[model samples]
Target chain A: MTRRWIRWLPAIAVPAVIAAGVLIVPLSANAAVDLPAKTPQQVLEMVATTSVDAFSGTVVQTADLGLPELPQIGQTAGSGSNAPGTDSGQTASIAAALEFLTGTHTARVFVDGPTKTRLQVMDSLAERDLVHNGSNVWLYDSAKNAATRVTLPQGDATVPNDGSTTIQTPAEMADRLLASVGPSTTVTVGDNTRVAGRPVYDLVLTPKSADTLVGSVSIGVDSETGLPLQVLVRARGQQSPAFRIAFSDVTLTAPSAGLFDFTPPAGATVTQQALPQSNSATGHATMPAAPPTVTGTGWDTVVSLPAGQGTSTMLDSPMLAQVTTSVSGGRLLSTSLLNVYLSQDGRVFAGAVPLSVLQSAATGR
Target chain B: MLGALAAIPVLIAIAVRVTSGSSSGRGPAFLDQITQNGLFVALTAMVVSTPLFLPLTVGVVAGDTISGEASHGTLRYLLAAPAGRVRLLVVKFVGAAVFCLSAAGSVVLAGILIGAILFPVGPVTLLSGDTVGPVESIGRLALVASYVAVSLLGLSAIGLFISTLTDVPVGAMAATVVLAVTAQVLGALPQLDWLHPWLFTNYWLGFADLLRQPIAWDSFGSNAVLQLGYIVVFGALAYSRFTTKDVLS
Candidate 1:
């Protein structure tokens, strides 16, 4: 009996060894690292002054806005509806935009300077690529079998912000968050950690006021390169991050030059466009009507759109009605970090504040 | 068995030819592309069969490895000969692994040949909207087959271990197939998110990464590592049981 049991020893030992290795490897990789200490101001100055560019990495964005899960009635209900009028059309477009904000998205980013860049959003069995090389920009969608070419004016190399490209890297998101680091925010260094296998300093920004929905923002600044590798936003009283964008893998080396060159494949519907001169400089021409007026400043700011901006038609849609609840004055769409109030009139109010604040702002207007 | 696997792509291609209608984005992922490019026929067939058909066939073959010989009253004679128990176990595993490879190969080969006969063949458009010549596309198809072959190896090991425990070949086959289905069911449950990564079926559809413009090797590498771990753990278990068990039949 003893000899027979010895024959089965390998079976028991092998699995135990593998389970131990699996548990230990990740713990060792995430072990605490000691880096050169730097104050919050010094880290902010490092991020502002660093000029390391021309790198390639893969970025993943995840959002958990605490929105109710909508049933899968059909793709037509969420996508472009065949209904003729602008009422269903605008509602369909808003529904489509909300789809991007709910799911996890993975995109490969390649930048070879300010002029040459490429972003490939990888979906399930499909891809959408935006290639910017010099004055030429190509947007290709494999599922639709369509390609669009936009020609920028001479000496203009920046990607046109047409609101279609909602995916952003950690660096771009950090820039937007850092702009709000004035008197209303308190900045401090939380911990020294590792991101994308590199040492990083966690710069935490906490809002001084309690009115804003945002609790705090944490940025992972690469210790050596000063590039922001990750940005995490947490809503008040939420344990998990409300929104997160981070580099899963990254390298500082410049990508291959051939990656920037894009020619529309045969059998694809191609459309040619030119970037408007005025829109190219400002980069915020998403709305056709006048820009919404701001009510307050800093985190408590509320944006109010005037009447006749098509807010009533969107609120009337059955799909939007499922997510929004009726408030005292209008329908209210509330999320963990943002709120929108659509009044009985065509006026609309939106902010990152609470629902009560948005309701008060609407009544005050 | 490979003949049946090859017939899948042929039937799919002929049906598309007869219907002569666009897929309208219904059915499997690449089913809609089959009308425009014949090469998509192979991809669609692979995607359709991966979840159930491939696993079922692999389970039958692997589950019959040891039990079939015992049920036929040939195990005692074979061991009575010069063949050692350890060498016989290794041979059975190698036989099952070969079947996994041929099963994937037949589907891909039939897809390419039928697609060429039915539609106009040209440069293949990848998932990234970039076009590659015929040579590179064939190379990519081969890699996809190998990735699928690797994906099934873990299930084969599980089936082989189960075969050593029973004298009835049918029971072994059914049990193996049940385990595969159970793993897939557990993988689909969102509440069991922590257990999803450990399932063997998690990366079965990851071969689509091979079709990208600059192929992503992350899934391929991860799948290979996970399968190798399964093989080591179960191969030892099978060895322990097969060597210690008596061949009274």
Candidate 2:
């Protein structure tokens, strides 16, 4: 009986492990995940090296509205909304929620109809980018000339901001969106369509992760130049409130440097409090080592951080286009409309991977 | 026109809940559920509108019932005979209550029929907390219709109180409708919540609350108890005032 049972255990064990893996850990932290990395400089060079035609179009947005009984000023609670600790609706679209994840940004989104347009802005929002710069995970505030670290409410979690992270540059957003999905993401080609004067490839990004926030995403690219012309996001949970960023007025040539500088409207408060900085400040850094591979998967990189050791940004479905990337312990995760940021102390004196390789090398140990 | 007029608001409330507000969602409080519950809807419309309008109809009958007889000198001839003054007053009060109750009764019966035909029944949706399913809508509507009955006590009390004051029933009936409306208007103000505990209109407001999701039992329970108190006090006032008043005329 023992010998027969032992023989049967192997078959059951594999399926059991697979089920356990899908449930216990979040999809963002797959140990055997790998992405191809390209640096900001490298990303810029890729853009500089390519030639594309400029297409002028308009962006449109449709929003659904609902009204609920509201608590009066200073009234902490009201009759209709009595669920303690749970907000009646989602808060993914609040300006404070996504203010930090992005640097200076821009994007051009095409609405469904031909005649309408919408302007999506990504200027240096004061006090918004303090945390990212202070934490040194990303950009410095152009106005403050100070490293910005996004400040989070003591115990609250954040969603990734789609506009700043995804639309910083046309190429960066496209590449990041392409990289965020994994091998499990299914790909398909759509009906031939033309935007501007160029034909484009239509790519849909479905999360390979078992639990993905994105229900569906479609990107229209300039087939001639490989540049993305438009992107659309469909998410879950944001029934009453939805997020949409359609960029119009595409200017490839710099808009006279003054367009990026942001000055606060007069009388707006500028409260500055220096953030605590340390070498291990991100709390997501680890001693650098060579990227490793999983035992069975064919991917080149393996990020095998133990459970509860990483911070990640995600766009939870209800608030489609709303994104969050967080880092805890030795793992960092960031999400933008275009790119997913994952990094550790990839800058080691010996056998360390490059910072840009973090997302691609995740499949490697 | 009167029947259709009173039926309209109740029906509108029911249709609104069915059309948009959580279709199968968290049900309204016992008060709010009335909006969806067919029987309560009918009862509410009948109770409220009849008090304001039907009394005038009753007054026309009453005004003629007494003064027409008095104009013919039947009261003087009858007073000279064995019939006592108290019996006449008693009969008048009873007849008026019966008439008012019967009119208001249509609100209840109509509410039931309308609720059965229009609302999805059986599982009751609670206003604040949920204990609802499709099957409860019927049973829940039936339960809430009782509150409308409680609301009608004021109508009868006012009618009876005024009926004792005069032989001309028309004047008494018109005066009663005006008093009821004044009370209701006073009760409707937002600032009245502090005084709602004291107002008889509090019971009328109770029926409206039944339409809210997750039936609020606390409000319903309190309204029911307070409503009984109003009936007892108001009934006693009408009885005492009628019993002691001059009847020689």
Candidate 3:
């Protein structure tokens, strides 16, 4: 009898495992555009085809970004790289920007003109999922279960690495170095190709700063695949080297509108960020901000308020440990390497963020 | 050296934290840290000492290499010795360069170690808009670091060059940093686009260029050559300047 049951165990377990997998499958299969598997063009196709409803994934791809290291050349420049996990924010933002630009992550980018308007929607470690839509931006920081919105400035070098709509993370600042790439910028083919099984071309951008830096960018593409493989930003003259972003595991599929869709929970708080006009969220909607309560705890302005409303909190104490910022908005309130936080309240939050990400987001803002 | 070493971690932590920006992402972490982040305070701390350290290291060496002799009134005696001005300058320049490298290296090593202790470093997981698997980050980061080291040769040379131009090592070190910063700020002008090609700092970015995917060897090589040229020119200039300058200390 035991032997018979044991044999039957395989049969029973097979169905059980299959059922278990079936349950597990749906967890990562959100209708969101977390498409780390799709190439840039494929992602564009996904944007073109997907309906306002279906599509999504939990995929993440990394490509080898070939950016030239900036040269410190003739200066006493180096931000100091001795801190360890301390730069986690900069690291995350840089990663996010790279992933978004290279299409290593799922994103919805809206460009109005060649150099005019742009917006990018993606996730951030600090603010959870965020949308850089025009001058108005929103974040759903699920961690703090809050939401925030910010009306940003344009034309200024507000964010790091972001020329128009994209932004750098806190750790992204770690990429700042003293390289000697001068003001002359050009695009050229690169040799360190073949990342994510794709071919790449090098796009070298010289620094606009008068600093003795050598800035270079290597944009890799998978030739046969015609997908962006990576983007590397280098500054050789800095005491510390620059940063790189690479893409791995790309797929092709149209993402449903649900990927960009966000709704505040019933009881979540919301912070509107004193901006004009709502996000015009085309899909399901979120909640509104709670009446102004004490904005935050005694410390931590970058905190989440009730009703998914978020306030930028940098709670430092004789009080906070570090200048740790907590963004509270929508369902996305969370800590970020950079001070900018995203929350679920249909808002974007940023206070003294990195210039790279600032540039990226600000352009959109 | 130890004080400088200590500053590296604090700076790294500040770099990591302040640059981490608002739960907001995408920008220079440093600016975020300084402008409106907690890391600013830490960075402030680093900046305070940074200015002092550069001079101290170079000063100690310069004083030992030059002033100490003067203080002992052995300037004439040393001049009387077989050491040519060029040889004396070479020895000091090389010594200062090595010190600069060592000082910078100390910070980097401390930073990585502190990173291991302070944060997760299983692999150097580079975060793009997407993410990298845990297994692959280390090798890539290692490559990144190597490139960084190569690129930093510019700064090292700058320090060396400055050291040779001045009998006062502290003055040399300070002057080097100032020149570096000035060049850095000036290198960004569209109007000065003409001047960029000749600037050595233009070549300092070669290491970062290597991080590009299908890394652009042509540009990278070009950048490397340009930087190498700058180093050689600067190095030679320092050599010549020091050899001919009369030691009046």
TM-score of decoy 2: 0.33
* Model with the higher lDDT, candidate 1 or 2: 1
Residue A76 miss distance in model 2 (angstroms): 18
Measured with C-alpha atoms, the lDDT of residue B109 in candidate 3 is: 51
After superposing candidate 1, which stretches have Cα over 4 Å from the reference?
A: A68-92, A155-165, A274-288, B21-24, B244-247
Interface RMSD (Å), each candidate?
3.0, 31.1, 27.7
List the candidate 2 regions with Cα displacement exceeding 4 Å.
Answer: A1-365, B1-105, B115-124, B129-136, B190-194, B208-249
Per-model chain A TM:
0.89, 0.34, 0.35
Share of native interface contacts recovered by each model: 0.51, 0.00, 0.00
Cα misplacement distance, residue B235 of candidate 3 (Å): 3.1
Q: Measured against the native two-chain assembly using Cα atoms, what DockQ does each of the candidate structures obtain, in the order listed?
A: 0.51, 0.02, 0.01
TM-score of chain A, model number 1: 0.89
Q: Where does candidate 1 chain B have its weakest 10-residue lDDT segment?
A: B21-30
Model no. 3, DockQ: 0.01
Write the number of the candidate with greater DockQ, choosing between 1 and 2.
1
How many collisions per candidate?
A: 0, 86, 233
Number of the top candidate by DockQ?
1
Alpha-carbon RMSD, candidate 1 = 3.2
Q: Once model 2 is optimally superposed onto the true structure by TM-score, how far is the C-alpha of residue A121 displaced, in angstroms?
A: 40
